[model samples]
Target: MEHDESLRFEVLGPLRATLGQSELDLGFPQQRALLALLLVRAGRPVPAGEIVAALWPEGAPASAMNIVRRYVGSLRRLLEPGLPPRAPGRRLSRGADGYRLETAEDEVDLLRFRGLTRRAKREAATGRPEPALRHFVEALDQWRGPVAAGIPSPARDHAVFAEIERELVRTTVMAADAALLCGTPEHVLPHLGRAARLDPLNESLHARNVLALAACGRQAEALAAYESVRRLLVRELGVAPGAELTAAHTRVLRQEVRSAPRKRDLARPAQLPPEPKQFTGRQAELDSLRTAADSSAVLLTGMPGIGKTTLAVRWAHEAAERYPDGQLHMNLRGFDPLNAPLTAEAALRFLLPVLGVPGHRLPSGPDALAGLYRTLLSGRRMLLLLDDAFDTEQVRALLPASPGCLTLITSRRGLSGLVAAGARPLPLDLPSTADALAVLARHIGRERPAADPAAAQEIVAHCGRLPLALAVVAARAASHPGLPLAAVAAELRRSQGSLDALGDVRTAFAASYRHLPDDAARLLRLLSVGCGPDLTADAAAALADLSVRAARRLLDELADAHLVDESAPGRYTAHALLRVFAAELDRRP
Candidate 1:
């Protein structure tokens, strides 16, 4: 076999001709189109009639053969410039039957992609799922953008490329499924989510999502997936879910009950770390949360680690008295970095057993699960703590219909939807100076106070009276028992070196800011640059040079994001640390 690897052609994005490392610039559009047609046939000779049909689908021109010869001559001269002086024919030779463009298989990305996909399928059929997943991922990586992204071809060829794109999507879902079956939902969830979005009507993609969600322990969300699929099928196709999907949904809802209790629940309970010693201030905030819990849903929105979860858990423990049935807790993994978000179906599965429902009896869809959950808690009073929720959709599906059931949702983003849905929102602020000092004194003994009251006050003010910051500062002081309070205050004054003062509190602020959308982030940066303790919507609008209405909407979005505190209606202010962070971000390129 004569091997010619130097010749390469790319037809995916755009038609290109190259010889070895140097690209051959085929100047004429007709010449480039002719070369693409030749490459598609690979080593096989294509009859002149087929070539004419491909170029002119409506009908061939009178001078079609002459035009083809002219384009072929132009392509050969452009692409085969380095070829040794030939004796009889060009590198792109015209046979009596038609024409042939020969190149090695390795030179084409499309052929390589197809080869890898085929190998993956073979590996999967042999039960080597792990290897199949790796191959499929490799094949996908070969695609830089959509298939034939920039290429303009005949309608027939375009149809062929579209079919290839669809196949690629299917292959991706299969790979994701293998990843899920291999016990790696975190790795597969992003792929599945992307696939789901790409082909929203694909039932297989939705089914794969359920498997991935269940593997991630988000069983409620898994069940919710089934409901979404069912609804889509009914709405779009006027059909119910297939038997396989219904069976899978049933299994997920019952998995928890069928499984035995985990060791932690049965064995001696593992002692939790002692509660943070200096949880001061927020008495009013706590009372408001309790009151909201008594009525509709209570959403506690604040900067991350701002003790939102801490306060929620504490209140749940305190209010455990009212909830005779029991208190239920779930960390929804709302802000997880590597996994798909927890869905309502998965959350329902976690909750059903707690409500004493048997595995087989639990509903298969979010609506059904939610209805059953409400029915179980209809008469009995219960407290639910849903921590780290991402969005309203996630929380809304899991909400209990019964007024007797009280829910406390802690999220970095303010649950505006919850508020609009008649759930009360209790926003948390940084602790007061006195509260911060008390927290510090509680954590690090009061001996230092008599020595330097001024220093203690200074430390509280410098820490911005944020409880998380004060706790960290207090912990640092407690760890160094002999350190003078004045020295600690001096360290805090040097903000750059005061890592010990902020600790995880800084992380909380960062988390909340990270969740803001691009527009909201821009608005925040402008707000941080402008003067005043707080700005009205009009002032904020002027700073960004946006319309008053536009700026008002942005400000509301920021407020809903919890990055900007709504001190008064239509007025907003950033927390001290958040202001500093936003200023730093704005100054950067």
Candidate 2:
């Protein structure tokens, strides 16, 4: 937001970056901290000695520099995937001193905060208190927690982080003083209170917290704040409230600060689910979704149980802040076993009321309700997550007319019609071996998987690296932590032709399988008869006892539902789990 660029680094919150509305995963803990350290000291080259020291405070091992080099290489590729082998990429560069991360003006959130603070100071110098306070509020708003929030301990307490925390405290106290000048001290209360808590013994901050709260007409809260700080100071430092704090107490007693009327706060619907728990991997798809944010809508399609909903919901959470008006989520139930897909009007009925529209106020027809929804979101910046949608028409009905809003839709079928329009198509595929192992490790600790890599590979293979399947199987293993991963892999291998161990996986496949046209379903079942890695259209036709042209059509239909992958032109293959599923069905009547 500060640089007006699509991609920027954030240091004030989590150790991460945002590319447009999408947040990039900055790799593991240490790599994230490294990025944070670079951002904190951006544009200044640090010697390798400083890098190693900051990363490992106690001591640097022999492999520390090599590991740092490896992390640097991985980060370069992550930030600029297309860079050539020997290229240093756009952000990080190596000089004689060591490595440095550079940024344009206001490209980092910390830099943006500093810039805002500087602007507020200038405004105050020019005697524009209101504008000064506005800048101060924005500057304070930039903080989510202490700098580089997700960095692990020890490194998190490094002097670099301490320096940033001091900057936060200074700004918070200054903003509080500016708040008094504008008579809207409430705007600065939260920041002041947080700063005071971070530095309880800093009487200046506590005094400002008290004065700000008192100025906002909350004397009781203000007195409580003073008392809390006083006790903390006494306990921690064996010192009572100092002069500034005592003066704050005296002013509160005399009611010297004039109170301002509070502004009414509007509640916006934050309807996206709680951040998609244990969301494992989809970095490329996430990057695609970020690019697709330029479009008003993006369709996420994959076979059932491939985690289309999880990926969409995860991306929605990352981008939710961009849509300040609100975010709306609805499961269209396109493939629900127990219920029919909600019609356009029915879905609108569920949504419009959530946006503060009365039920009785909803229009009678689909077109009318859609019109009202579009009108309500006419100029608003909002996010609509249309999950499990049946088709393009169902999605188009609920889409906002405003360009400022973004819609993310997930479905089993490709929904090519929307893709034919401007919407980007993001097909969520199974994870790679490493990512699949990571998913299992997230549920069951890394030790089990790390100990038996081959067994872990076998388990992922049997599960076809499908996220839902891996999650279910790994969750069972996690429930019994002492269980051997080889035992789990052996069980999965023994149950090869059935999803008995994964009833949920079977259920997900059945939901998509049941929706197929008769010919396509039969072809899928006959897919079990093939022994090669994949089959040509003519070969598949021979197996299914259909004409080559007819087989091609059915294959296309099955591909659209993601039941089969057309691995090559005129060739196709089912995922391992799907093949076994088809084999089981073929054995049936």
| CA lDDT, every model vs. true structure | 0.70, 0.83
Model 1 TM-score, all chains together: 0.52
lDDT of 2 by residue, 1-589 (tens): 3643366888887777976667888888888878888888888887888888988989889999999998898888777758898698878888899999878656788888888999988865544455677898898888998789898776788898888898999988877766665456778877887887787688888888888887777999989988988888788888888788998899888776653222222236789987877787788889898889988888888887888888888999999989998899999999998788889889989987787665654545686466456645655788989999887888878877578889999999898888887788888878888899898888888888889999999999888899989989988998888889999999998887788999888888888888888888999998888659998889888888889999888999999999998888888888888988898899997
Top lDDT: which candidate number? 2
Q: Candidate 1 lDDT, tens digit per residue, 1-589?
A: 7644386667655666567667778765555666666666667797887777776777778998889877777666666664554422445787888998766667776677778889988866544455676788777665555454433456336345566667767877777655653344565676566667667777767776776677578888888888988998999999988876776676677673122222123222111223434555678887776666657588887765467877877777667677665667778877654455689889889777765555664645676566445544544566778888989999987776556678888887876788898778787777667777777888887878657899999888777776677778888888998999999988888774224357576566656566677877888877667579999888987898888898889888877767777898878887776777677677769
> What value does the lDDT take at residue 14 in candidate 1?
60
Per model, state how many residue pairs clash.
Answer: 14, 0
Candidate 2: give the clashing pairs.
none
TM-score of each: 0.52, 0.55
lDDT of model 2 at residue 523? 91
Residue 395, candidate 1: C-alpha displacement in angstroms: 1.2
Model 2 TM-score is 0.55
